[model samples]
Structure formats: C-alpha cells, structure tokens
Target: MTKISTTQTQDMHSALTQAIRSEPSLIGGHEKSLKGDAGDGSTVVVSAEEIQLMGIAQPWDWKPDPVGQITMEKFQFCDLEPAKDSGKYFSPGGQSFSSGYRDFLALLSPDFQPQSILSAVKTTNQPPTSGASKSGWLNVLNNAGQLEQKPSYSTSESPEGWIAQVSTQNTEHKLTLEFESGDVSVATSSKEVSVPPDQVYKIQITATAWQRIQIFPGTWYNQAIITIAKARESQYLAGGMAQVAFGPGGLINSRVSEFVVAMMPSAVVTMDEQFASSQQIQASDIQQVKVGGFHFSKGSPESAAKLQPQSVFQSASAGSGKTTISASETHATHPYILAVIIQKFG
Candidate 1:
C-alpha cells in the first residue's frame, strides 16, 4: 500500500478547508444575451473596471478529462448437483447445504424419482428404511405428507414477552407470535421491531394463517398489485355511462320500475318488462287498477289488453257475476274491488 507523508496530508487538509470557504451557495447569477453573432459586426469585451469593482471568485480553470469506458463482468450459475445424505449436511464452516437431494444419502433409494411434483403418489410399495410404513393408504395423512415437510419454528423470548395473538375471522386454533425469539416482533400497525442479537429463527405459516380476508372482490386485488390500475381505468371510462356519476346528470338514487317489479317474488321478469313499457300513466295513477295479482295503473288494462289474449279477458267476465254472492246487493259496491283485492294480496 502506498502512504502519504505527514506534511503532505496536513497540506491537503488545509487546501480543502480553504476551498470550502471560497465557494458560494448560489454558484452563478443571472445571464444576459448578446444580440449579435460572433462573425457579425459586433464586438465583445469584459469590463475590467467592473471586474476590479466586484471581485467574485473565478470559475475552475481545469478542463474535463474524458472518462474511460467501464465494462461489467457477466454472472454465471454452476450446473453441478450437490450431495444428498441422511443427517443434515453441513459445510466445513457449519453452513447448511443448499440442496437436499445432493446433500444427503439414501435412507431409501435417493434414486427414486416421483412422477408428478404436485400429485399424490408413492413411487414404491416399500416402507421407510427406519420408520414404520407410514406410506400405505390407511396410514397416509395426505399426499403432501409423503414429502419431507419443513419444521416450524416459534419462540416467546421477546422483551415485552408474548405467547401469540388470535385472529377473529376464522374458527381454526391459530396463533401469531408477537416475537419469535430473534425473528420478528409485533408492534403498532405501522411499526415492527426486529428481534435482538440473542436469536434468529424461521417460522412456516399455513394457508390458514391468513385466517381473515376482507378485501373487496373482483377489482381490489388487481388495483393493489398494479398501482395505477384503478386510476387508469377511471380515466379511460370518464364521460361514459360506465363511469360513476358526479354532478347534475348523475342519477345515483333514481330507481327503475323494472327493479321494483323484479323485487316481487312471483312477478315474472318478462311480465315486468311488458308492464314498465305498457303502464305509461302519471305517477299518481300507478295503484288505480288490479289484474293478475299486480297493482296496475289506470292505463294498465289498455297495456295488458295489448299483450293479453282476447280469449283470457272473455273468460274473466264469465266468472265475475257467477260468484256465490247470489245477488248484487250481497257483493262489494265497487266493481273493481275484487280486482283490487287480488292485486293487493298478490
């Protein structure tokens, strides 16, 4: 290594202090234009009198040297497989082996290759070399259980001390530790404290760990992943009927007659469509008549007449006078009262 003498180091430090003092915060003042081009009949000169009057610091006199080209080295991954064995494989420095198949030896033939990575299957009919046959149908917990499952970790060694937290949305017995000895610590919503130097552990969480999800359906997930998605969708849909309404023409509260008709459980959707188009009466006349279990407008008979078969209206008239009433006096005073009753109850 090269070293600088004491005298040179002292001189360098002194020069740096002087350079810092001479520099001004605002490096340059406003500039003015000179009208004529260089080859034109105009002359340029610096005012020596003004230069002497306001002695500002001179600009750096050094010219910029050209920078040499820099080429970055490309990265490569080795294709070699690792060793595989029974006990946990360790490096000379005690680091765990990165690959399982290459690191450990066969308790059973490490040579066996399963057909599908995701599917449920046992490649061999034989049992484990050491453990009893947990491989057969009755003994198998799940297809996933066949593979080596990673061990889970947990700890309560936090400074504040905590066992775990419970979630409200699911029925499963789940625990979320506030701190895992030397991994993570639970704090306020926006903050988290890391575990201290004593320990560092890893914990595996299950699908049930999510436990609760209150995300808005269909669109919220898309919006979160691609940040400007919602804003871009809004901008694209602006000024169209698909857009949410804003000012004057926006009819957020306005209800459609078809929706009101659809709310009736027995009302056929086809009939509701016909009714909305046919009943063109004033709002006050909507309840004036009754037919086929629907409260009809005054104009509804005319509307229904246009759609109803001629044979059906004639059949209705024959039944009106023959009711067990036996006489007009025993009947309702209003001729349309029976129709109103049918409409109201229906």
Candidate 2:
C-alpha cells in the first residue's frame, strides 16, 4: 500500500474546499471535508481528477477565444413547442393570462425588432376643394394662386359692420364701414356709363353727419373718395370743409368741391344729392353740365365762342337807417382767337 505525506494531504483538502465554495449547488449541499484518517495514520486525500469524475465540479482556467474570431449561428425556434391554448389561466390574485399565448408568438416575430431612426418625413399631396385639408404650415403655401369671383354688386351686413362690393370691366372694389351710433345710407349711379376701349375708371363718394341742436347749430360732416385704377390698384382722394357757430343765432355750414378731368373722347357726368336737415329753414341748390369733345376758339363757331375762357366780378354794399342802401357790381371777360391760312394755285 502507498502512503501519502501530511503536507500532500493538506494541499488536497484546500483545493476541495475551494471548489465547493465556488459552486455549492453542484454538490447538492453534501458534507465537503473528511473527518477520519487512513489506516496508515495519514490524513485521507483525493485527487483533482477523481473529484471531477464524481460530478462535484469542473476546471474553469481554460483560455478564451481571441476577439472577432467567434462565429454566431442563425437564430431558430424549431426546438420550442407551440404555446398551449388552455382557455384561460388565472393567478391566485385574480390576474388573467388568456392572451399570454398570443403575446408570446408576437415576441418571436420580426415586429419585435427595434425600428430604424428616421431623420425627415414628407406630407402627402391631396387635391384641393372649396374648404378642406388645411393644416400646419401647409395652409400658408397651398393657396398661393387662386382667384375668387365676386358679383358685380353685393352687400353684406353684420352686427358690427357692413361691406359693399362693386365690379367694373377689369377690377372689383370693396368698401367696409363700421359705425358705433348713427344711420348709414348708400347710393350709386343708376345709369350705365360707357367706357372707351383700353380705359378703366372707378368713382366713389362717401358722406357722414352728426348733429345735436340746443337753440344753436352744433353739427359735424365728413366726406371721402375711393378710386380704383385699371391695374386693380386703389387710390384715395378726399377733402372736406366744416363750419359751426355757438351762439343763439349761430350758423353751421359744410361744403365739398371736386373737379376731375380725363383726356378721353367723350364726357359723361351725373349728379347725386343727399341731405339731412334738422328743425326748420333749410335750402340747397346745385347745377352741373357735361359736354362731349369739342374745340373752343373765337370765330370758330358761336357755340365755341360762348364757352368762356376767363371771367372776373366784384360787388360792394352799404346800408344805413331803415331804408338807405347802396350797391356796386363790375364784370370783365377775355377771349382767345385762332386763325388758319390756306393757299391755292391755278
């Protein structure tokens, strides 16, 4: 029989103790150390190879493969059995796992992979309708080149304001008025005025008034003009004058004067009157004339000579007592004449 030394026996015991501590579950919690000595009076011992054969443990000191040299196999699920359809399974706490089988199948599909990060996205183009598909910054750039047809004349009113529309040969004009307290009246020419070829014109007149009488005249007046040009552009021309007196026999008056000329073939004019009088005693008069194209010069024609080119007048007045009165008046005129020459040969 061979005998082992005390030092060898101690070394073997230390190695066995370390392997047990590293993986206690492998040994199934069995006693690790020996208590009795061999018959030869030396400590009992066991070899490292013998311990491995008993399924106690295996050595883990082997070197790992070099980086990037390892190979991976394609993923597969052939070994996994299909999930059972046992109607439903409930836990002791009343939680249902009826759909657990379907969830497990979904986890194994390609849909479970993480999606790729996106950098940009585009919107889908859609056909335009009267009023639809408006969203985000899309609304700003979508309706760039569209025309809205407006009627020749239309009026729309709201609680806060009113709008009036008028159309001409090549343009449309709109007027909006807002008022707090007062009456509003609008009028337009009833007779149609013919426009020559390649020419356009627009005319608008607006008047407003407010008055309060307390034994004297307390009144306000305003007027404005709006003009639309041939190229769909608008121009405004307005001028007004107002006067008021504050005493018991005071007088208040307002006047507006306008004259326009266009170098065209024919002339057509119309006059419209609008007035509002308070109490009693009021009077107004207006006269206007429109003429076609003509030439004015002396000896050309009696009609042409009658068209006065320049005129001046003066007057003076004096009164005294209850019946004395004196007055003077003066008048002056100037005219231009044009002469033509012609020659004939026999």
Candidate 3:
C-alpha cells in the first residue's frame, strides 16, 4: 500500500492543477464560485443549529472546508486493478484468467475510508478588511464651542466613545470616523449625543479644547457581537463524522444546529462598494454568480455547489432547483437570500 504524505499530497494537487488546466472536463466547471480570499486568519465557524433557526444552510455548505482533502494526493487520483474471473489475460501457466470488462470492474472497486478531520475548521468568509482602522480622528468641541484638534483613540479599547474639540481647521467636517469592521460609533458635541453611565461603554472622552480631553470610565463589553465569517471551501478535520469532540473534553457535533448570523449593522465596516459600484454589476439587476469561499477545492462548479445564495427575492418558481425552504404562506427569509441567489444564478 502506498501511503500519501503531506508533501506528496501537495505535489498531487500541483499535478491536478496542471491536469485540470490541461483537461477542463475532469473537474466539470468547479472553479466558478471562487471570488475573493480570506487570507491567513482565524477560522470562521458556525454551528449547524444556527443554520436551522435561520432557515439557511450552513455557511460551510457554500464555502466548504476542503483544505485537507484538496491537499491530499491519493484523493486526487485513483488506481485500478485487473479482475481474475474474466478470461482476458493468460497466466504464466497458460490459462486465461478473466474477461477484460470483469478485470476492469475488479480494479475499479474500492473500499473507501474518507480521511477524517478531528477539529472544527472553516474558511475565511469575507475578504480581509481593507481600510478598516481602529484609530481615527475624533473631533468634538471646546468649552467655548470652537473646533479643536482631532484626537486619536487607543487601539486597545472597544465599545469606546470619545468627545474632543474638533480641529479648528476641520470644524466644518461632520466627524469622519473609522473603526475596525465599522464596529465603533462616535457622538459629537451635538445635543444628539447621549450616553447612560450604567450602559456598557468602553473609553469615553469629555471635550474641552484648552482644558484637555477628559477620559471617562465606562463598561467595555456591555453588548458585544463577534462575527466569524468563513469562506466556502475550508477544511475541518474532526474526530467523528457528524459527531465530534471540541477542544479539551466535550462532545460537540452537528446536532447543535441553531446558531445566529448576527446582523450587527454597527459591525459592518464596509461592503466592497468598489466591487459593487464598478458598473460591472447594476444595483437594479440581480445575478446568479459564484464567489470563492475558504478552504475551497480548485474547481469552480464544485466550489459554487458548496454555497447557497441569499439576499435576493426571486419567485418560488425560480427557487425550484435551489435548496430552499419556504414557509406555508410567506417566504420570510429576507435580504440575504436575494444577493446569494443572484450571485449563484448569474
């Protein structure tokens, strides 16, 4: 038996790239869904239970974790052996052993033991945040109501708010602020600014241009929502098939199906508006297209199959072939499916 090594597997994948490029039919349109990249970051995991509650398939379904499988070589290519019952080949003893078709079938049969992954893993969902920053200029007002200098916030803090004198030069500016994943918000010196001391707030600053900014103590983790976005084809090697144990000592499996896709608008740093606004995609038009997810296989069709479209509202007739669930009287799955379906269909 020929055992497959990691390097050997990579070599096999390399060979597959060449082979697939040389012969497109082998992969059968598997490369179409890949779009952006997740890069070297932490895994974005979603429990199966979460999928059920949302009436959406697992994100992994769209972006499968194929990391380990794709990296393996033997899986890239299979072998066949000749059969003994068919009278196709003459033995050294001058006896015909088997028929050609029988020999072929015998060689093709395999006892498959799918390589098992022992840990929960996922692919990067959305691309790495670009232009997202933790520190930005927070401009407030001086006690005299004059604009002061913009002060940078501490990167270590979260759910933090600041009030400072706006730079005299930037007085007219409406406080252009930036934060990681668009998570943080700033309230200017305007009357609209309101904060409850009991509510969880990270760092806060009281504004006074000449008097120096006052840093107030507040709760940092009051209401925190951590989103983990995963790409379509990342690999997850766990100890069991559907049932697996997570770190340290507990049985965690796909049975825990209700997880939440927290739509924290504040956390949305930015959409790839550049990609969305290039005139390549029309705002009014919907498309069924495929974009790359994490740990994906090399082929497009296969990659696309892993993802389920969301954020689009097509007629139920349009949803026929797609794996969609509908409520008796209404299609309650909103906005997410529309975009998903458009991307997939287009």
- Clash counts for all predictions: 10, 0, 88
- Candidate 2 residue-wise lDDT, 1-346, digit = tens: 0111121111222322333234333223221222222244443111111121111111111122123111110000100111222111100112211122122222222322121111010111122354453221112111344432110111121111211111112332211111111111111132212222122111111111101101110011100000010011111111111001111111211100100111111111111111111111111111111111112111222233333212111111112211111111111121111100000000
lDDT of 3 at 87: 25
Sorting all predicted structures by TM-score, with the top scorer first, yields 3, 1, 2
TM-scores of the models, in the order given: 0.11, 0.10, 0.15
Model 1: residues with Cα > 4 Å off, grouped in runs: 1-170, 178-180, 184-195, 198-346
Top candidate on lDDT is 3
- For candidate 3, the 10 contiguous residues with the lowest summed lDDT are 337-346
Better of 1 and 3 by lDDT: 3
Which residues of candidate 2, in runs, are more than 4 Å off? 1-252, 264-346
**Ranking of all candidate structures by their lDDT, best first:** 3, 1, 2
lDDT of 3 by residue, 281-309 (tens): 32223223221111111123234443333
The 0-to-1 C-alpha lDDT of every candidate, in the order given, reads 0.18, 0.16, 0.19
RMSD of 3: 29.4
